[model samples]
Target: MSRLRFLAVPAAALLLLSACGDDDAGGTTSPATAAPTSPAPDAPGTTDASTGPATVALSDDGTHLVSAEGRSLYLFTSDQGTTSACGSGCLENWPPLVAA
Candidate 1:
């Protein structure tokens, strides 16, 4: 009886820990709720399977490009045209507009 109880306690703890494991909270689309096969032709921007529709808007100051979702896109002056100078650490704060 004591040996059975010992095994059961650890098994219960393992189940609890597994339930608490980290989940991707970045709002990624799951297969169940994936984007539709075709976007509306009248939609304002281009749609991709992975990232959905993307559009460019002018920043409030009219200085930079903003996403349709209103996230600001920045360009590094240090980088030449169409190149990124940001490292992984910088990305944590300012995620890239394009998927890697």
Candidate 2:
């Protein structure tokens, strides 16, 4: 259990750290979690490939990623691990955030 905790803690911390931002004027900005890349056929769990990567920045509260047009992106708590459970049906109610 200790071994799992040791490894799990850092992994969780890294994910948490990636979402962190400084809330101040002239504060540093976190890099986009997903950078622009050519739509490749082999990539797993890829988003819409036809569109370009969305330019995201931390929200004013520095809690989450927002789109270039200033839309707050959210994740479904129901998503299993890294795989999104939200599908065609769920999108209508909780639309997935897509940006250019």
Candidate 3:
């Protein structure tokens, strides 16, 4: 019984040490796959996903207007939300169909 106890203690220690040995049997972990993120929310009075110049709305007088940032459109307006009177000078600062 005393000899068995001596053997048991050493065996248990060896078993524990063997279990904790450096074993890289498992392959390296590849990076986790992440889902594609959608575009961020639009700012106040802005639009998204409409890149470049696209005619958004027609002027009351039937003049064509281009949208800015495909979201926030700038047009010649005598009143609010109007796009009819943007002169060449104004268009220079806010070019129509300009890249973002």
Descending-TM-score candidate ranking:
2, 1, 3
Residue-by-residue lDDT tens digits, candidate 1, 1-100: 9999999999999999989987644433212222233332222233443555345666555555666576876655765454456666665666555421
Off by over 4 Å in 1: 1-53, 60-63, 80-83
* lDDT string, candidate 2, 7-95, tens digits: 99999999899779554644557657456533323223336755666677887767777866667777568776546677665665555
Which 10 consecutive positions of candidate 1 have the poorest summed lDDT? 29-38
**Model 3 lDDT per residue over 6-87, tens place:** 9999999999999999776543432222223333233333344345223343333333332322234443345233233445
Off by over 4 Å in 3: 29-100
Indicate the residue-level lDDT of 66 in model 3. Answer: 25
Could you give me the TM-score of model 2 versus the true structure? 0.42
| Candidate 1 Cα lDDT to native | 0.54
Q: TM-scores of all models?
A: 0.36, 0.42, 0.26
lDDT of each: 0.54, 0.63, 0.44
Superior by lDDT: candidate 1 or candidate 3: 1
